[model samples]
Target: MAPESTNPRGDLTSEVLHALSKSDPISSTEAFPGVPFESIKAALDRLASRSMVTYEQVEREEALLEPEAEIIVSHGSHEARVFEAVRQAIDGLSIQDLENKIGDKTVTKVGQGKAFKEKWIKKDGAKLVALVDSINDVTRDQLKVIQETRTHDAKILADLKKRKLLKMQKVISFRISKGPKFALEMVKEETDLTAEMLASGAWKTATFKPYNFKALGADQHAGALHPLNKVRQEFRQIFFEMGFEEMPTNQFVESGFWNFDALFVPQQHPARDLQDTFYVSDPVKAGRPAPASADDKHDYEAYFQNVREVHENGKYGSIGYRYPWSEDESLRLVLRTHTTSVSAAMLQKLAGQRKDGRVPPARYFSIDRVFRNETLDATHLCEFHQVEGVIADYGLTLGGLMEFMEIFFGAMGVTDLRFKPAYNPYTEPSMEIFSHHKGLNKLIEIGNSGIFRPEMLEVCLSDYQISSMKIETGGRR
Candidate 1:
């Protein structure tokens, strides 16, 4: 049938309103495929001169239509008989009505129910097409109307398929043409006339080629442990070889007594600022204090008294900085602010025991992750590991602590170290450890070492140490 001359889309001028909507625009040569290539090319040049449709060389994949969309393995003949049935029944008819009016095959299907199983259609039983079922084999013009009115998936695309609308057609076929230009006015063949053998099949090929790529191996491969981790492991070997027991990897989340107050960080200490420590997001039960029998009670009472005396009257031979300690501050749970808390608990375990009272000398070490808030960069990490060591014995000294640190570092092949006087609220006469990083050409402060203040030890462990050991890697900022 000839298309109507009274075009409903009106004019080319009107098409400009929907210029962007028009997909799969083909050049004149492609539009009239059966015509001689040059004649259609000349027509395209003429159309370009008058600007009917602009020509472009875009990557066709960028268009809305895709390659797989072109090859619909549709069922059923697109005969006008099927069209008439669908048109009359779709408005109010159900599947049974469709089957009765059309055929059982329309819904129950003649073969495997692959399309129906895909849920593209609903069936009352078998051999009936649903009123709402989508149809196939439409032209570009039919697709435009379907698109404007679509309330279902694949309908517009399927309609365009019915009309043989193509978003992209490879020109390789036209490139091998054997005819001259202006061979048009030739009768269009409705049926295949190539007389090609049915057994001829499609084939494809695969090959490899390189394009733009980026630098994938940018990180250095120098054989070295991660700087932070290397430090942590060095810690474990150092203290274990020094005869210190390993501290608990138990709950790294610690209460105020173990984290701050136990370590002599006063309730008012600015270091307890939220930005300096990570606090748990939720609240948890803090249990009742450990029970103290009369003997334990006397020991606890005695430790508290001595600690108070040291803080107020210089029991350690120096007047301690006095600040009120709050039990609430001791209750807050934080990332174990220091591995020293592990040692503090260990001491509490060993408190009140002499070699005669069945207590043995003990030292301990911890190599674990610690966290802090810091600006992130290649140089600064928000969380890193630390190496901590504590010694609990009858007679340990600051000189012994220094010798241990030097020996441990030396065994780890760390040669360059320096110690300078520093301060920790929990330690007395503290010294900060520094290392020389030859690559950076600067003296890097490595860690801290100090004698734990007697008052701090008494609160955490409530045991008066004849001497205390405090060594830490990754200093508190």
Candidate 2:
């Protein structure tokens, strides 16, 4: 009969310790006769956790036969069969005749190859003949021994494994022994004071478990912001310090109209191609912006029409790209390739303010994710972040844009600065900014700066001068 447990968990621990005390080193399978193996293992682990018992694992590699090896055992091995067929024939058989006798293409092919390699069979002109009058089929004999004994000679096993006839399997077993604190008899430790023991004045002698101050505690996993978000917060603080209001950039998907057409990007531009942008498929198109209300001061619909007209023909004293414009193409949905889409929307809002009254000098900034159809690599990704800023006032110039870059990057300790002439569809006289990296001992192009083109701002803020700059800060890999 099995021993009854007083406390199931405590009794299991006690039983393990008791078994170890008698045997010194015992297999876990032999310790608990009636208990499930998993249950015994769990109890052993609990004991190990408390340092009351220790265990060593033993692993044995045993050879097992696969289906092909089984066939070799039931029938003869391929090479052995070939040797037998050759020896029995008075005149050696030809390759064609040998294949007919074997009846298996695999056996004929593999058997002939191994037989020749071992020199067990040699060619007698066109006939295959046994090299010796009598031969031992070593592979067949070894496989038989392994099948019966469930073990193998190391060298024999290697050949069998190479031929894929034998598989080596690892079997793990455990040896458990009493640890330093192990004891046959156990006293359940009281974790707290009881009212009955206190009233009877027995609490004074109650046993308690010793405190293990050296034992490590469970890990506490706490939430943390992503590294990009941390840098974004720092950037937000910098923007606030520079007295720039944060622009809302919650929308990741934008209509092609605002993202491209409104920015004066021609419809035929390659940036709108499938290779360069990710377009939304389901609910594939977005509703056009509502036309300006007749009574409304902002006149958004009027602005939309004016933007379309400018793209299709000349406007604002400039000859536009004289090409057909499609409102359907403008309504197509896409993942915004840049945060400048947000800037475009904000500029339209600023235009509405201009319509209401005199335009106030304003500074806006954004830090957020943007997507592209880029092939991913060590330094480039399909999606990344952009730190974008725009300042709108009367008479802002390319010089004002340059000064802002110096002060902004300079505040972050980037003092060495150089600018080169560049171009953008929406920005005239664009300049690419580069900063000297002391560690790299070279200049790295950091960002792009330019004054907003008259064509882009004609409808939005024709009355105000605007300059914009965008700096692409690389994203997490």
Candidate 3:
């Protein structure tokens, strides 16, 4: 092995631009010897894009997940957290470093299983002495449950059974049946049927074709969707079955007017930042266009009125949001950070016609990709889909929200859940929903829900009445 270079360097592009200005089309070997040619080509293309060079970049390889990397970072694992923390702490430790530290070992063989077990016990005697006390009743009980759940290897099962906490009870039973009758045999020379002479006739030699009978393949597993995704599909189907029209799919690139400003999010809040959301290449945010002058005779004046009412306060005699409403800053564009964005859009679609008599009990659902600059981890992705739904009409309340959440989770095969107070700009008295997972022994925050605030209502509904009314303000209770 040779020692690698550790010299300080100038920008590759700056170097390339300087050389290209003076040299004829130089080959990658001339440009970056000892460096990968593909990297050299990329620098040239970037330079060319800015009119600094005349070369194109060819991609050498596509990025792929390493098998070992995938194993240590898959979701639903607390183990990954520890693994990552330990790996980060071990600075300057390489695979070769570990190998050198472990040194060489003598491989031994034993024919008998018991001999191998004895050897293992003897080798790890000190560790076993320290570990024996921690393997208490609860530990054994949990291990038994896990073994039963996994149905692992037979030897492992036997070891588990030997632990004394493991138990398998046998129940024996049998049923009697009618015994066989006369003996039967195959004979090549068949003769005289239904007569005593044919009962015991001489048989001729018989030969059969050679058959190479071998064991084939094993059983196949049925394909299935993930449980979370199945729940999302169910919600989607729920809305599709209802007559309420689905909202437009333009939210992934919606303006602040529809996402935050129209929905009454305080501009000073910390959520609207690159750290929390993805900003688009362009910043031309749009807002709910101001309604025509109060003196104008436009028929669409009623639409803006509904939006204003939703933001200013709750409709239908509900206590309106008391915050000073501003439409000027409501037009910034970014990723649809949450499915709550869909609810606002849905309300806009039903902006008018409350006078026509269609109001409360309006139902809508959306299961689509939403983006947020989340911390990527085993169970979390940079962006993921959410199942968003809302049922609106007069007399909708927080109890209804809780009831729907329970029913929805139950239908999705999640029987255990706990709720905590959460705040969302769109939903007043919002809640963060937590579900208990058996393995982890603690509640995991799964989703969020809340009753839309009056301002939210005004923004979404046409027949909204902006007045004080009874409502349980959302909070951690």
Candidate 4:
């Protein structure tokens, strides 16, 4: 008959209990040197779960011999082998003859150099001859000692490691001790009470397992706003706190007139080219701009004529582009290239306030997506977000614009700003806003700001005899 199988974990648990009965504490490494570390930890965990025992983990680093060092320990050092081989031959041995005798070209070649360096061998013409009759292999002796003891002098260990003859490995063990519920034998315990146990009056004496309230429970995945939308919300809150109204920029498709002509952008501008703008196809064209509501009594026809005349010829004491502006081009529908198109429409409505009374000082802001025909790259994309703000009031100066920018950017923790002179089609004395970047160690352009020109405002506010108005606009991507 075959012998019965033994359970290592059960045997180890029982042995641990018996050992603990005699000693208050014991080390797993000293008691079970040959046992696997994982198995010992498992038995300890099982006993600890029942409050019968406890343990602490112990870690240490051990040095061991490499395959090459082991071979040297089993046989002899390379230099010693070469000396013995040469001495055994009455005459001398050639290079090929030495390799054939050793059956290893690498070992023969390395051994020959070491023997020569030690003055144990000399070159006798094309052959090698032994200079000594005997040798003691100190390398083999050191490796043998390390193989048995797992350690040696620090300098020798470092030298052996540098030569790729040894390596270090981490070893884990445990120190165990008895707990409050320590016992020689494990007793069966109930985890839950049943109806039969209750009816049999056994629930009163049942030893229920203790609940581990500290144990972590299952994770509950929750919904959250996207990172971009969260930032948009923060910008909106900032604008609201500054007494700015949000613009309706939900309309992605817009007529070219509101996008460019009313903004005083010429038809020959590079931004209107097919290479830069994404023109819509299905609708073919859009109707003339009209009132958004019947209550809005703004003159749509006269406003359209003023935009055409201003772009084609000089108007309101300004020299226009002098090119014949095409009405068909103005009506063509296209994807709005920037949120500035919405700002223009809002400004046009604000101009109509002149008919009711004096146009009030107003502030408007928008954070929305815009489309462009851009080459895809690390920094450029066809679709992206644009942040724009328009502030219109009487006697708003360039200094005021700069101060407003400081307060606005400072709210988001951005400071130390510098402005560079730039040119824009619709704004006079445009400035490119820049901020110092600590990471790049240079100034980077953050946005653009400028005051609106008379040519752009005249077409909208001309009906109320308002030739020009101070309107500041700032934008960033």
Best by lDDT: 4
Which parts of model 2 are misplaced by more than 4 Å?
A: 1-206, 209-225, 291-297, 355-357, 464-477
Off by over 4 Å in 3: 1-231, 238-246, 287-328, 355-360, 462-477
Score each candidate by Cα lDDT: 0.55, 0.80, 0.50, 0.81
Which regions of candidate 4 are displaced past 4 Å?
1-217, 220-222, 463-477
Cα lDDT tens digits, model 1, 1-477, are 112233233233223213323433332223232444444334444333333444443221111333322222233322323444544654444545545665546333322243344333444444334443354533333434433443223555555445444242333211112123222222222233233423452111222122226526678879887765665666666677778788875677877656765566666677678877777767742433453365553254454445445544444455655655445555677776667777776676676554454346677887777766666897777776677878766677888888978987788676688889988987887999888889889888878899888777655444454667778876221
lDDT of 3: 0.50
Better of 2 and 3 by TM-score: 2
Q: In candidate 1, where is summed lDDT lowest over 10 consecutive residues?
A: 172-181
Give the C-alpha lDDT of model 1.
0.55
Taking all chains together, each candidate's TM-score versus the true structure is: 0.46, 0.54, 0.44, 0.54
lDDT of 4 by residue, 1-477 (tens): 111234344477888899888887886545765556666777888899998998888877668899998889887988888888888888899888888888887788888888999999999998889887788888899998999988889899999899889998876677899998999998777888899999999989888888889878888676687777877787788889999999999999999998888889999899999999999898979999987788988888888998888888869888889999999999989899878778777777887776366676678999888889999998888988877888877677788888988998788777898998888778886888898989889998888888877788766655333322222322333
lDDT of 4 at 449: 80
**Residue range 1-477, candidate 3, lDDT tens digits:** 112235534566556555544554553323444434445555555444334445432222112223322322332122222222223432323333323433321101111122223232122322111111111222224344444453444565566456442444332111111112111121222322434444554222322222325535577675687776675566666557544455556557876665665566756667777788777766666545544377543344465555556556645555655566665555667787766666765555555434456653566666677777888888667667666666766666677677767766676577677779887776678888888889899887777777766665654554554211111211111
Task: Tell how far residue 44 is off in model 3, in angstroms.
Answer: 68
Higher-scoring candidate on TM-score, 1 or 2? 2
